[model samples]
Each structure stands twice: as structure tokens, then as C-alpha cells.
Target: MGIENILSVAPDLVDEVARLKSIEECKILKEKIFMNQLTKAEQEVFALAIDGHSVSEIQGIPHKEEFTIKNQKRSILKKLNTPSMTEAVQQFQNLHQEPSQKLIRTS
Candidate 1:
């Protein structure tokens, strides 16, 4: 329907639609910010860290030396704005939380 027709039929719906559009825009901005903050290598390191891999194990991977892996870990922490490994893992996990999983809690 045209804007004028929609406005005449339901003015309140226009406001709601605008609000939902704003929310979706914010989500897209946040995702872009997160992606821009991390380098490709840092993202790989972050994923491995989330998997509970040790530094040595990461170093064992092709093209990843100990120094490079350690540097990537530091960069990941910096990009995620987290101080510790635990917090970094938690932050990454939180970003990927499923809608259903968000409703569940463990005591």
C-alpha cells in the first residue's frame, strides 16, 4: 500500500514500523562494528579460543606460530574490549546466543 493510504488506514502502525526499522538498523550497525574491529586472523584465534584450544595447539596449526597465535590472542582481547580469556569467551558466546537458548538458564 502507498504511504498515504497506510497512514490513513493506521497511523499508529507507521510509528511501530518506524520503531522496528530503527531497531533493525541498530542491530546491523552493531554487527558491522564488531566485524570491523576484528581482523581475519584475530577472528580465527577467537574461534579457537572459544573451542578451549591451548596456545600450543593453535600454534600447531599450519601458518600459525606461537608468537603469531599469542599476538592474535592479544588482538582479540583488545578488539573485544575484554580483559581476560574467560570474559572474551563469554562475550563471543553471548554474541552468538540463539533466541531459544537465551531463555534457558542453568543454576
Candidate 2:
């Protein structure tokens, strides 16, 4: 039987399954990030950029020079194999959204 059939027998299983799936997805995403060879600093920069932070804003957050932040962003793009910050953000969003979309569709 499929998960939906099993879920109908025990409605309480829904939340637990969703939680476990979320954890598993997080682990997989971390593995992907590690495989991309980004330094911790570069990862932070990538996240900030994904959140729509500008180079100047990212610089202010890290108290770094604008040039340094720009370089970091460029490095993040290279490591993630993305052409630009916008594409990188889209890629990240797509990665994270897949599990949620699956859950929604199943529900």
C-alpha cells in the first residue's frame, strides 16, 4: 500500500512523516552544499544573497569591504555552478522547495 493508504489508517502519522522527511531533506541539502566546496564564509554569503541582500548590505553585515563581499559572492556562484546570484537563489529555492511541494501534492 502507498503512504496515503497507510496515512488514512493513522492520521497522526502525517506530522511525524513530514517532520522526518524535512530532516532527511535538510541532510541531503547539507551534503550537496559540502560537495560544492564552499567555505563556511562563502556559504553565509550565498545565503545572504539568496535572501536578497545587496553587496553593500552583505558588506555591512560582515563588516567587510564591498570588494571582499563581491569576491565572496562571485566565488559562491562559481562553487554552486550558478551563472549569477539570481540564478543561484533560484537554484537554492528549488532545492528546498521540492520536498514541500511533494508533501503538498500528496496531501
Candidate 3:
């Protein structure tokens, strides 16, 4: 269920996760989509969703209307190739395993 377990079971996913590095370049984003076939917009909207925004809140920050925000979310789900936003974001978060100092580790 943990990230290390995922990496062990599927190292390719780990390699895929490295694209999230802060030091990564914009060109890499293009490569990830054009070459690797990963969903770029899904990743962005996924991050926004993780930050706890309602569709209206998301629209506010992005300066888009609610319907547009909803459309973007739909597009994001399609690109991520998931049935829903929750599933896509959850899998992306689980797979990427963003390092957070604010988090407490019990293990």
C-alpha cells in the first residue's frame, strides 16, 4: 500500500514519478506528455484538488467560471485516464509520494 512497495512492485512507476521533481524543467513536461503519454493538466488540477478547493474556489483562483472549472476537471480526468477526479488524484499522490516536512511519520 506504501510508495516503496509500489516502487518495488513497479519500478517504472517510480521512474514516472521523478517527473514531479521541483528541479524539473518545463520541456520535460512536454516530453512526459508527448513521449511518455502522461497527463500534464491532470497533474496540475490534481495538485489544486489536493489543496482542498471547491469547484468555485478553483475557478476563483484560476479566474475561470465554475462551468469552465468543471470542464477542466473533466479534461483532467480524461488525460489522467481515470474514471473520476478522486481516483486520479489519489493514485497520482500515492505514486508520486510528495515529500512533506509537515507530515508525521509513524513507521
RMSD of each: 8.7, 6.7, 13.4
Model 1, which residues run further than 4 Å from truth? 1-33, 96-107
Q: What residue pairs are clashing in model 2?
A: none
Better of 1 and 3 by TM-score: 1
Highest TM-score model number: 2
**Better model by lDDT, 2 or 3?**
2
Local distance difference test scores for all models? 0.70, 0.74, 0.57
TM-score of each: 0.53, 0.60, 0.44
Lowest summed lDDT window (length 10), candidate 1 = 98-107
Give the alpha carbon lDDT tens digit for every residue of 1-107 in model 3.
99888768786665445543422443344335432343555455556877765655677765556776677788777766789767765755553343332232221
User: Model 2, 24-106: lDDT tens per residue?
Assistant: 77757655765368787787887787779876778897467778887888888887788888887887777655655553434
How far off is residue 17 in model 2, in Å?
2.3
Q: What TM-score does model 1 achieve against the real structure? A: 0.53
Task: List residue ranges in candidate 2 displaced over 4 A.
Answer: 1-8, 11-36, 99-107
Clash pairs, candidate 3, are: none
lDDT of 1 by residue, 12-97 (tens): 77766766566556556555566668888887876787789876777888977888888888888887788976787786566545
lDDT of model 2, residue 64: 71
Q: Which ranges of candidate 3 are over 4 A from the true structure?
A: 1-44, 97-107
